[model samples]
Target: MTGMKDVEVVVAHSGRATLRVGDVFLKVDGDPANADIEVQAIGLAPVPTPTVLWREDPVLAIAAVPGRALGALGEPSTASPAAWAAAGAAIRTLHDAPLPPWPGPDLSDIRSKLDRECEWLLANAVLPADVIRLNRDIADAALRPYAPAFIHGDLQIAHVFVEHDEVVGIIDWSGASRGDAMFDVATVTLGHEEHLDDLLVGYGEGADREVIRAWWSLRSLNISRWLIEHGFDPNVRGCEFDVLRARAQER
Candidate 1:
């Protein structure tokens, strides 16, 4: 770990910090267990993930995955439809893989959390009461039990990298666990709803659109407060607030 000349902060927060030094990424998690989970999850993933360079307590160094992120939230994607499809196919492969040793939150836990989040939203006046109620009703479908699959629990678009219409890699495996596969699909397509058709085409047919939409509501409600607390604006164009508002309009 010499020549640390061009160290750039990738992300920093109370829970974790990530830095880039040359071609390597150094991640420091507040919990050493999270670092351990990341290392193990990367090993279990069926698709390309950053190579672990080394690990020391809370710090883990990983070689950078190639290519840019698929796209950013609140920004238009320049990736071709094929690239999006490739990402969907990659997710399909992950879902089809043997389950990770760790299980994610069960449906009951998810429902309880969703109830708490909805209460928080209403108490804080985060959205119109009617809007929150409508979305909560819509979110119920997603809380039903489904056979768990290996999932990139936080499959945001920015975590999936692509080059030349192919998936180069997926990053941030700290959240990987056995969970509902449609949750991954909903997460990647969040804020990029127009591309859902392309992704589903590659993921194979017969996905439950209602459950996917329910996940959209559930995820949006669940993360909005955390995003605001972390100094990020969920109200930004094309972000969570817009997603909620759009769902309201559909009601």
Candidate 2:
């Protein structure tokens, strides 16, 4: 805890904030439940995770996991295809582990939420109605029930760490829960669709490409409002807006 000469802000918004100090990360979440889930999920995950150094109300201190994030959204990944495949292997390990005790959003709730989000998008003129409609229809395929698996609810590329073409660890477990495994697959590849084949190779074969695409549409539609509300511009190149537009143009 000494030699805290510099503190770098990792992320900050209304919901939560993260700071990096030397080799430790300090996370402050508005909800204590998130902290609890993170601790438990990391403990259960098969992959390497940041060690929990300490915890105080609303603040959790974790030793840094070695290596850099796999990549960032809206940016081309410089990591090798092997690294992407390694990340997929790590995700497969996590999915194979026993499901967390907590339940995730049921299909009914997901459908309801998607409906509400679509309605909001139209009512507020967030996107062209046709764009919304097309993605909405595509997203419908993801709403069907499936066997749940332990999921890293927010498996963005930036949350995965890689070194020497191997996955060292994954960070940000607050969203971990029992959910559709395809959702995790889709999430990890979001805004970085070019890596999908590499990832799937390591994830194993026979995965439903259609379901993964549906999850992409579902995830983009579900998160757009929150991103905009939190001061992020999804319209940035290769981000959510672009993902939706790309899907719309397909077929």
Top model number, lDDT: 2
Clashes of each: 0, 0
- 25-125 in candidate 1: lDDT tens per residue? 99998798788778899998989899999999778999999998989889988888999899989999999999989879788888888899899999999
Q: Rate the local accuracy (lDDT) of all candidates.
A: 0.90, 0.91
Ten consecutive residues with minimal summed lDDT in candidate 2? 1-10
Residue 71 of model 1 has an lDDT of 91
lDDT of 2 by residue, 1-251 (tens): 86556989999999999999988999999899999999999899988898999999899999998888999999998989999889888889889999899998789889999999989888989789999899999998888878899999999999999999999889999999999999999998999999999998789965789999999999999999999899998899999989998899993
What 10-residue stretch in candidate 1 is worst by lDDT? 1-10
